[model samples]
Target: MDVGVILLTLVCYALACLLWWQLHTPVFLLCLLSGHVGALASPLWVLLYGVTYRADLGVWFDVLGQPVYSSVVIASAWFYPLPALIILYLHRVRWLGARYTIALLTFLVMAIYHFIIETIGLGLNIWSYDAAPLLPFGLSHGLISTALAATISMVLLYTVLVVQRFSLISMVLSLVPATLVFSLMIQGVLGAPFWVSLRFAESQSWVLIIGMLSTLGLLGWAVHIIAWGMDHMNWELV
Candidate 1:
């Protein structure tokens, strides 16, 4: 990692801690930790994508001959969780009247936020995708893929953390749904069904639709469990 990136990450971490203090929600740390784990776990999916599609997600900077970028990593792990945490805090305090409403709105807001950041990042050559397909008016597959993946991961992380008490087990379990949804979204964007996408082959539309619905159903059930846990368990700062 570059020295500047490391310094900036520390500064961001400090600000995050300060935000946690001001918000009086120690769950901020847990959410941040979950985001970090999610980001770290991304390399596995990145490798799979690279092998399956020959695409590179991003390359802001490299460290130790690896494609990891510290600035992006820090943003994804730290800053990305702030909006979700704020929304969750509001919901927890009853300022937000409905959980599902807050959840849906949060997801939309985060998706647009990430999409804008990705557009700027692409313009600045912070990253590039290989032979990316263009959408209307020339938006590339890279921008859409990154934005959607990041947004889904953020919202899922927030939902899981809010619904379940903070614990190692809960955090790890959260990754299950998050990763599953992420993989499904990416495969959809890549124009393939789940199994065929993994094999880097073409897929039928019906198969794609079925896979997406099934995965969404599974993810919805996981979220329901989280919601039930939230209502039944008296969550506390650990």
Candidate 2:
């Protein structure tokens, strides 16, 4: 990890902590938690895709021969949730008002932000993809994929908020939209039919993607249930 990246990440983490203290809503906390969880879980996807795409993590520093990119991953977990919290705050203050409207707006904001950050990183040689995926209009390694992934993760977290009871079954079902959207986006971008695309990918990649998705879905659902249960218990005690 670059010293600069470490310092910047710490500053951002401090700011996030301060913001959380000031706002302190269950919904906001949940969003923060979800983002961190997603970030932590992203290595599954990264490792799977490493067979084809390689990311340059800015610097070559290592800990016990392990790349310091782990720090970057941890920092990203906190950073990803900031947008969702902001959108939710806007809604709480009656600025956005509608749930679906907030959801759409939040997705757009996050997608654009992801694109900008990714472009900058690529320009700085902070990361590069090997055998890059194709995008519309003959572009390669477009940031849209990352944006879509982030949006899907946030949407899944948001779905938990709208539900009265979080269950494994409900969580699995809620993933359908995100899974479908992601699959279609990748398929369209790569200009490959869905079944053909899977056939081309290594079998291990399929297993990893499936495992990662399932793990994330279960983790998000667990967090929602735990948070809700705590709230319910507090109400009962009162």
List, residue by residue over 1-238, the lDDT tens digit for candidate 2: 4566567656655655665577543344344434444443343333323312235444234433334455455455445555655554564455654333344455567767667766766676555655433323443444434544454545444554453144545534443233334323332332223223333445435543443344335434533443454344333222
Cα lDDT for residue 142, candidate 2: 40
Worst 10-residue lDDT window for candidate 1 reads 48-57
The whole-model lDDT of each prediction reads: 0.49, 0.45
> Which stretches of candidate 2 lie above 4 Å from their native place?
1-4, 26-34, 50-68, 99-102, 133-136, 156-238
Q: For residue 97, what is the lDDT in candidate 1?
A: 40
How many backbone overlaps does candidate 1 show? 0
Task: Give the per-residue lDDT of model 1 (tens digit) for 1-238.
Answer: 3455457556656765775677554455555555554454344444443312113434554433346544556655544565666556565565654344444455567667667766666675655554322233354555445444545544454564554454656654654345344434543433233333333223344553454344445445544554454444333421
Candidate 2 TM-score, C-alpha based: 0.53
- Quality of model 1 by C-alpha lDDT: 0.49
Runs of candidate 1 with Cα error greater than 4 angstroms are: 1-12, 19-24, 50-66, 92-94, 132-139, 142-147, 154-238
